[model samples]
Target: MRAAVLTRPGRFEIEERPIPAPGPGEALVRVARVGICGTDLHIFNGHYAAESLPMVPGHEFTGTITALGPGVAGLEVGRRAVVDMNIGCGRCFWCRRNEILNCPEMRQMGITMDGAFAEYMVVPARLVIPAPDDVPFEVLALTEPLACVVRAARKAQVTFGQSVLVIGAGPVGNLHVQLMRTIGAAPVIVTDLSPERVRMALDCGADVGVTDPGGLRQAVLEATDGRGADVVIESVGNRALYAAALGLMRKGGHLAAFGLTGPEDRLALPILDTILNENSVAGSVAGMGQDMHDALTLLVHGRLTTAPFTRAAFPLDEIQQAFDSINDRPGDLKTQIVLGEEDTR
Candidate 1:
């Protein structure tokens, strides 16, 4: 088997590696399509926390089960599946509370273990979800990414008929636009510095897409008759936008901060306004079973197709080209690595 290994920061090379066999409670999956996410880029750039050198760097992938170990009862050989990257310690306090994302010993497959950037990868049985029969490999591969957006939406609690603003128009932000429309059925305002991303946001059902966040805030105020947005989601991880979201949110509204900001990242806010307006902010991490289920349902039923967002594909051997395509083309939404010459199933 061939795998792309991140030997060190700013270095990745495809090399021959031994195929991993399924262990107890694990399954070996023949990779099909792997979605290139910002986290992959962060790991490539050496900014990821748990990502060490010489690791496979992919978490969003759909594939067929080639083999299943003892105790892996549900998934059958040749079953199409998508793996939830996070492996939580079941006995942790956070896991006891059903907050696996906050578990002290959480290990993400792509970050802490070898991931799906190859011909074969091993995954825990509990983390593998059966892909809907009707969903194509391209679409099923998006379930994990969409699940993240669903988690953010769940945290935001978007309400129907309410005004919502999504800050940023990247892949995650674009998903937010679609989910906000589907769940809230309300007009959505999206903002991004990239013109192409703004256009993508509009195509994804944003009522308005602006290239300037401050300008978009003004437009949101005007559209809401000066009341401001009922809900604001910051997806760009920009400190400036984080502070701005607080100001743009209407009284009693909630702000869902989904971006992964650095430890030193901080934003200023009006202390009095937060107290007087009763505004609140919360962070959302990985998805739970329910979020993943909703995301898969949407994909299978054609409600959340990523067709408009998928920009390019490359063979697993050309993984470097895929990453280059993602970085060079600011307009590109999602790039994927096609793992094999033929489909496994």
Candidate 2:
């Protein structure tokens, strides 16, 4: 077996390693495709605080079960599956409250455990969701990220006919736009500095895509007949974008900050203004069980197409090239690594 091992913050090696076996309550999966997420880039650049060195950092992936541990019911070997990266102890207080993402002892795949950037990875059986037979392995790899989008949309309380604005045209941002539309919202307005992404967003159903704000507040107000967007989702983590998002939102609009902020990140906003406008800001992180399930259901039903989101693929041997391409290619959407020869075909 071969795996991409991160021995240090800025270094990774694709080395021959012994395949791991499934422990009790775990399942051994033959990794087919692994989506290289922004978190993986952060880990590669030493910017992710939660990831430790000498770890495998691939959370979004899909595979086939080669073996199942004892006592794992409702799951069978040979089933196609996608990984749910968030692994939490069921006994935790947060888990008890249906908020496993907030659990103190949460151990995410690729962060605390060997992730799917290998020939094989072991994960708790319950965390593996069955992938649709028609869904390509590469597309199935997006399940985890899609789950995150679903969670954020829920937190934002996106309603039918509500005008929404998503800041950022990257994979997550684009997904946000598409998902919001699925729930009966009006075509979303998307913003990003990359003109290529702006165009891409238009192809994917964004009503308006702009590099500048495009007088977004003014434009949206006119579209809504003097009312602004009902919900503003800040998928871009830049601190400056926070204030900009607030400015574009309606007086009583809900703002959901889905992107993670760095520890030292700070924002300067007038509290009184936010209060007077009846504006509320909420933050959402990784998905819970329901989010994961909903993501798979939508994907399987052909409502959430993952094809537009995937841009490139690389063999496992050229994992470094995969990372480099994702970093250098602005036009690329989802860059995935093919961990198995069969999957590449």
Candidate 3:
């Protein structure tokens, strides 16, 4: 087996290693495609506090089940699948309540354990979900992030005809736009620093895409008929964006913060304004199994398409170049590493 190991900050080494055998209730997957995300960038830059060194830093991936360990059933070898990265302690209060994202003992696959930045990976059977045979593996790799967006949409309680303001027109932001549109959200406004990303957001079904924060308030007001947005989602993860998102909501509107900010990051809010307007702000992290299932369904049925977001594909040997492409191309949505030949249905 071949794997790319992040030995340290700003460094990666592709090395050969023995193929891992799946433990009980686990399955060994031959990774076909892995999508690099913002979290992967943070880990690569050594900014993620929870990520340890020498980790195989990739979570959003799709593969074929090469082998199943003892006790594994239902899923068979050669099946196309996507693996959920969140591993929560079954005994935790949150886990018992079926809210694994809030589990105190939650461990991420790429952060706390080895991940799919390799030709093969071993995943717990419970975390594996079957992928549709017709969907490309590159697009299927997006299921993990799509699941998170689904969770965010649910958290915001987005309703039909509601106006949504998504702060940041990145990959996640575009997904939010499409999801909101799918549910009849009107005037899905997306903002970004890059003009290309703003255009991409518009292409991804956002009704309004603005690059200038200076004109955002007016844009939202115009789109909502002088009222603020019904829901505001902050996907940029900057303190400034956080404060601005709070101000963009209508009275009694909901704000879903899905961005991953720095550990020491803090935002100054208008406390009295929030109290007076009855605005609600919620922080969402990762997704539940049901969310993943819904995301897969959406992809399988062509309700959600990642074609506009997928920029390029690279081989495993050019992994560093793949990481560089992300930083060098701000407009690029999802840069994937193609590890092997994908199943052609």
Candidate 4:
């Protein structure tokens, strides 16, 4: 099978190798489609943790199960599924509490392990969630990221009529906008450096989209009646934006920092302001299984769709170009790699 291998930072090599067999409690999946997300870019650029080279760098993916390993009772071959890349060690303090992202030995499929950037990839059977027959590949590929946004939304806890300010209009930001609207956030505002992204966010149900910092501040203040947004979500992974996020929120607002930043990143908090306003901030990582279920339920029922936002598609051979397209086309929402025929049950 052919796989795109990131042998080092800023490079890829498409090479042929023997197919890997699923170990005990695992499954072999024939790749269908893989979404190239911000994390994929981080992995490709070697900014991700520990910087392991010569690995497959795709986690947001959907595929058909080709085979199942021993003891894998609930899954079967020929089934369409989405793999939850977060593989916890199961016997840790974090995993025991169902907080797998904090497990010290956690190995993400695309981060620490080989992910779905190939014709075939082996995934733990327990991490696979069967996708519905009628769902399109595009939606299937988005299940993971949507699950991630679901986590962020839960952390932020924005309810009906509450003001929301999403500080990024990228793919993730658009997802946040749609989720916020679905949950009844009133006058949802999206801000970005790119005007196109801001427009895209507006199309995704954001009541206001601004491209400049001054405009964002004005929009937030106006939407919240001179106070601030009830909930502010930073999705752009910009330190400057994250630093300024607290100043854009209400006195008792919460900041859900959802973007991934450098490992050594630090924040300079306004100690007195935080104490005076009773403001809170929380760091949310990727979602767990239940979040994926909620995301899939939303997608299948047509409550939310990336169909309006997702536009770019590339074949595996053009993987390099696909990565380049993210930089080349900032206006597009999501870019995915089509491994073979776009198929369903």
Candidate 5:
């Protein structure tokens, strides 16, 4: 088996290794596709603190089940699936409360352990969400990020006939636009620095799109009849965008802080306005058990589409190019590594 090993920050080596066999309660997957995102970039560039060097870092992935270990029942080889990457100690307070993402000791697949950035990878069988056989692996690879967006949508309490604004039109933001419309939000709006991305967002069900934030206030005002958005999603991870999102929300709107920011980043809210307007702010991270299930369900039913980012795949040898193209080609909402020839079609 060939694996792209992140031996050090900003470096990778295609190493040959024997196909690993799963142990008890684990499963081996013949990886078909792995999606690259900001998290992967952070890990590669040394921004995100990973457990060790020479780790196989890839979380958002989809593939075919090839083998199962002892006691791994209900999952069979040859089945296609996506994985819920977070693994928490069951005895922790947060895990006990079903908040696995908040567990004191959490080990993610790609972040902390060897993940699906290779021909074969092993994972806990319980975390694998079986997906429909008919769906393409390219599209199925998006299930993880969409799962995180599911968590965000729930945190924001997005509902029918409400105005929602997504402050970014990249991959995750594209999912937000689609999910917002599927939830029946009216006039879903998106703003981004890339005009092409904003246009792509419009095609993904954003009723309104603005390439420049300069004109976004008036657009939001006009769309919502001057009440501002009922929910604002700050998925850009920019402090300026966070501050701007506050001003774009309706009096009682909820702001979903879905983006990642620096540890030291902070913002001063307008105290009087926050109290008088009844606005609320909530932070949401990646998906957990139910969120992954719901995301898979949505994808299976065709309620969401991955048409905008199903292509632009790279092979294991071109891992570095795949990471670099993310910034080079801003309009390419998604970049993935195709692990098998069968999935590339």
Candidate 6:
């Protein structure tokens, strides 16, 4: 087996290793496609807190089960599947409450543990969700990020005919726009610094797109009939964007922060305004078990299209180039690494 190991920050080496065997209640998957996420970039830059050294940093992936360990059930060999990255300790207080993301002993694949940046990886059977065979591997690889967006949307509690303002038109922002529409959010508005992404957001069902911060406020107000947005989702993890998102919401509107930021990152907001306006702020990270299931269902039903957001696929040998494409190309939405030559569709 061949694996790309990040021995340190800004360094990766392709090395050969013995194929791993599945342990009890685990499964060995032949990785097909892996989507590079922003967290992977942070890990590559040594900024993400949970990532350790000499790790394989790829959480969003799709593969075929090659071997099932003892005690595994409901999963068979040769089934196409996607693995949930967040693995919570069953004994944690949060896990007991079914809030896996809040578990202090949570271990995420590709961050704390070895991931699918290789030809094969071993994963717990319970964390593997069977993917529809009809969907392409590239699209199936995106279920992880889409699941995160699903969690964010649920946290927003968007109601019918309510207005939503997503502050960023990246892949996650576009997913938010589409999900908001599916959930009955009307006149979804997206704002991004890149005009190309703003256009992409519109293509993804956003009623309005704003490329400039100067126009974003006015656009939101006009779209909501001067009342401002009912929900504001901040998908860009920047301090300025966070502060601006706080201002884009209506009185008593909900604000969902879906982007990942550094542990020490801080935002200076008007505490008095938040109190007086009775605004609700919530932070949502990775998706839960149900979110993953819902996201995969949406994808299988053709409700969510990842084709427009997907870029070209790169072979595993060009892993460095894949990371570079994400850093250099702002317009590119999803960059996939193809581990096998078989047609994943």
Work out the TM-score per prediction: 0.94, 0.94, 0.95, 0.94, 0.96, 0.94
Q: State the lDDT of candidate 3 residue by residue for 1-345, as single tens digits.
A: 899999988788998999999999999999999988888888888888344888888998899999999999899888899998888887878887658868888878887788889999998898899886778887788888899999998888888999999998888888998899888999799999889988888887899988988999999999899879999999888888888887788998998988878779987767887798888887788876888898888888788757765658888899998887677876668898889665454
Best by lDDT: 5
Q: Tally clashing residue pairs in candidate 1.
A: 0
How many residue pairs clash in model 5? 0
Q: Candidates 5 and 6: which is better by TM-score?
A: 5
Give lDDT tens digits, candidate 1, residues 53-156: 78888988888889998888978888888888878887788876657878888888777777888899988888788885556788888888899888877777
> Comparing candidate 3 with candidate 6, which one achieves the higher lDDT?
3
lDDT of 5 by residue, 1-345 (tens): 999999889888899999999999999999999989888998999878555677989999999999999999999789999988999887888987658978878889888788888999888898888988988898888888999999999988998999999998889999999999999999899999888988888888999998866899999999999999999999989998899899999999999998888889887789899999989998898987888898888888888868778768899899988886678877678888999635734
Supply the TM-score for candidate 5. 0.96
- 10 residues in a row with least lDDT, candidate 4: 302-311
lDDT of 2: 0.82
Among residues 3 or more apart in sequence or in different chains, the pairs in candidate 2 whose N, CA or C atoms overlap within 3 Å are none
Please report, in order, the local distance difference test score of every candidate based on alpha carbons.
0.82, 0.82, 0.86, 0.85, 0.88, 0.85
List candidate 4 segments past 4 Å from native.
Answer: none
Where does candidate 3 have its weakest 10-residue lDDT segment? 303-312
Name model 5 segments beyond 4 Å from true: none
Poorest stretch of ten by lDDT in candidate 6: 336-345
**In terms of lDDT, which candidate is stronger, 1 or 3?**
3
